[model samples]
Target: MNYFVFGGSGFIGTHLINLLSKKYPNSVVYNLDIKENKQNGKAIYINCDVRKSIELDVPITSNDIVINLAAVHTTPGHPDHEYFETNILGAENVTAFAERHNVKKLLFTSSIAPYGASEEMKTEITLPMPNTPYGISKLVAEKIHMIWQIKKNTERQLTIVRPGVVFGKGENGNFTRLYWGIKKHRFFYPGRKDTIKASIYVKELVNFMLYRIEMDKTDVEIYNCTYEPAFTIEEISNAMMKATGMKRTIYKIPGGALKFAAGVIGALGGKSFGIHPDRVKKLMISTNISGKKLKDSGYKFQYSFDEALKDWYKDNDNLYLK
Candidate 1:
């Protein structure tokens, strides 16, 4: 089967492409992205932005599968309008391409952000109440994909995955920030160390996506892609310390004080320390998302947090201090 990935240069996309190439040596894979990066020799790369209309030189047919992974997803990174421009508009263009080519299946990588910042455990049954522009835009994109599925009726299969914070070797997001802090021996507990942080290792997430597609499940199926029994901040820190063999003096600070400091830092346009009000606020909220749907479907997660951390450290030894 041919695989067409919209955003095939990003961290998750890169891992997915490599996995597909290794697993299915004979299958053809096409990557469409704005930037060109070194990819597996088996995959073809095409420079195209999903924000505008997507016109691929290769012929896409009903036998092929389309995976939409492109989006402006970094929070507090892009302006509000930019999220809508890339996510919403990008979804439209990708869906149009699938419709035009009559692709048999389309898989989308949405985010848990659409569940909004909440202390409650979120599942597939929970109603989306997205507050941030990124979250709102992702929810809208999911709806657009659903519309296409409904239009296609039984001819097309749609799978929507709302992944939590995904982390791996190439990641430079929240988890990476934590790793850097721990490596420097300056890591601290922002508030309650017991606050839950939902996450999935990049490899496990990619594996799950492939498993679902191979199952050939018909119609629309949505799953929150995170490991079961989400890890607490303290547990995550302990795991990282164990994995890297670098134990630090973990300090505890009051939530209110941290918020005030973050506010001052934000006012000063200070992102030097990676501590801003928005980030601090997010840290305080518990993202206790559930992957019960995926679990109930008889899918077993391959890597635990400890295993993932070990793999990350093994791959990027330079990130740690000597």
Candidate 2:
């Protein structure tokens, strides 16, 4: 068996590559990415852009698995056209290549962004109402991959995992910024102390991917990847402290004052600081995504909120706040 992973040099993809290497020692692993892996994985890296036609000379059998992780996922970072261009086009290109090569198994990582920002719990049955360019692009990309799977009736297998905020190793996103904020004693609560942030650790995410791909009984399997109830801001902060042995005096600041301060900080020192005035509203908005579908599938979570933090803290994270 051969594993072909597009955009495998990225955060989640790197972890997937590492796991694939260990689990299938004899199997060849090919990572088609624009850049090389920074964490030293066993997968051979090949520079290939997914937005256009993907050309490679690797031997691929019909049994080989192809995972599409290539996309412009960062919100508020890219222009509207960039997201559609990379995400939508990449999906079209990747699925087309899979079809031509007769690759039966395909995996994709879609985000909970399609459900949009909501305090209400959203499940697989919920209708997608994406608001941002990133969310809209991801939703479209999911549909594109779905069409590929459905075209073959029962012959093609596709697994779509809609994850919330994914954090781990090389992640430079929300969790990493929060960790740095708490460590520096600069972080403070904006409003409601219990805002839910649906999330999953990278290791658990990839492990679940491996589990689901083999266990999927249908031609297409779609499930949410997040903690069942979601983690409250307080819960996440406390876990971060306990895991890293970091001490910070938590203070509650008025939303306006916090926003002003965040604006100044974000302006003075880019997104690296984690706190931005424009993003302050998100701290209070609850993203209550339901993971019941995955939980009911008999896949036991290997790490709890605290355990995931402890593992990430111990690893010292590959990117940002290093």
Candidate 3:
């Protein structure tokens, strides 16, 4: 068996490649990305950009599995066109590769942002109302993959996982920002602590994807990947406090004040401090997504927020001061 991973140098991709290399020792792993992944010695690095069409030097056989994890996912980072260029076009290129090679399985990691910023619990069947470019691009990418699956019909397996804010060690996203603040005892709620932030641990997500692939299910399976009973800001803060044994006063700042500050920062051309107006707005919105489908499929999550936080702290203890 061979594994071809697009965006293999990324956080989730790095972890997934490591797991694949260990699990399938005999399998050849190809890491395709614009940048080289020197971290995983076992992976064969192929310098390729997904925004354009992919041309790999290695031969892709029918037995190979293609996993598309490439996308311009960071909100408030890139322009709208970049999202479509990378995500939508990247999906097209990946699916094209699968079609050309007659690959049996293709797994794609999409974002829950496609369900839009909603307070209500969202399932896979829910209609997508993507507001942001990142969200819109992801939804379109999923459709592209679905088109490929339909073309192949019963012969191919397609797994599309819409994961919510996935976090763990080495992750430098919203969770990392929160971790930095909490570790420094400078974190606080911008508004009500009850704002839901549905999330999943990276390790558990990778494990589930591998498990689903091994099942050899010949059909399209779309899952909203997140931990059960979506976590709130207070719950996450409490877990972080408990894990690090750092009990600091967490104050609630008014949302208006935070937004005003963000506006001021934006006006001043300030991208530092990790508080952009768009990010502030996103923080205020509840991403209450449901993982019931995955749960009902009999997959048990290995790490809870507390366990994952504790493990993360252990790995990054140097970043914290007593």
Candidate 4:
């Protein structure tokens, strides 16, 4: 089988590529990344941006399975337009390419961001109330997949995996911020530390995606990908401390005060708070996601918070990124 993965050099995509390469030793895997995956020599790397379609050295065909994992994730300092171009336009290009080549299956890795930032528990049925362009883009991309699916009239398999905050080695998401800060013994414990984080580890998320692909027979499916049990921010902080074997002072600020301060600071700057706005919001509320749909698909999460943190810390000893 021929497998094509977009953004194969990214945190989650890289791990998935490694796993797929090993799982199907005899199969050919091509990674379409803006940057090459030097770590994985087996994948044929193509340098191109998914936002604008480009001709591939190797043409895609009906037998190929294309997985689109490229997007401007929710992060600090990124312009909203960037998210639109990459998340929506890039997705369109992937679906177009799949249809043009008559690809068999296309898996899109979306986010739980579309479900909005709220203390309320979320399920697959939650109406998407995306607060940021990052979330809106992901939601729009999912729609594009459906649009293309209907137009093509081909037996194209589509699976949309909406993952929560993803973290692991080489990750740059919310988890990275906490892990790095804790590693330096300069962690910030915003709010009362009781806030729950809707999070998922990268390895398990990748496993869920692949397992769904293996088991899927339908034309379209959507699943929320997250850990079985969620953890509180306080629990996570403690786990981080235990992982690093270091004791540090945690500073707690009132949630309401922090939110007010973030708004004032953002107004003063004529822009969104670089990092504090999102952080304060997360610290103030519980973000819970249900993964029952994915869990029922016959996959089990084997890693705990402490174990994931320890492995992540050991792998990235530098711990600090400027």
Clashes of each: 0, 0, 0, 0
User: lDDT for model 2, on a 0 to 1 scale?
Assistant: 0.86
TM-score for all models, in order of appearance? 0.95, 0.95, 0.95, 0.87
**Per-residue CA lDDT of candidate 4, range 173-201, in tens?**
56766755665543456557777676777
Better of 2 and 4 by TM-score: 2
Computed on alpha carbons, the lDDT of every model, listed in order, comes to: 0.86, 0.86, 0.86, 0.78
Candidate 4 Cα errors over 4 Å, as ranges: 151-154, 256-277, 314-322
Candidate 1's error at 195, in angstroms? 1.2
Per-residue alpha-carbon lDDT of candidate 3 for residues 115-226, written as tens digits (9 for 90 to 100) = 9887988999999999889899999999999999999788899999999888877788898878667766545687888999989888889999998999867899999888
What would the per-residue lDDT of candidate 1 be over residues 56-159, giving only the tens digit for each residue?
Answer: 88776788989999999998889999999999999999999999998879999999999998899999989999999999999999999999999967787899
Model 1 Cα shift for residue 32 (angstroms): 0.5
The superposed Cα distance between candidate 4 and the true structure at residue 130, in angstroms, equals 0.7
List model 2 lDDT by residue over 1-322, tens digit each: 8999998988889899899999989988899988897663688888999998987887888889999999888766777899999999999999999999998899999999898887888999899999888899999999999999998857888999998889887798888778888888778888767888899999999999999877645478888999887888888888877777777878888888888888887878765667777578778788889988988988889998888877887787522332
How many clashing residue pairs are found in candidate 1?
0
lDDT of 2 at 93: 95
Q: What does the lDDT come to for candidate 4?
A: 0.78
Model 3 global lDDT (CA atoms, 0 to 1): 0.86
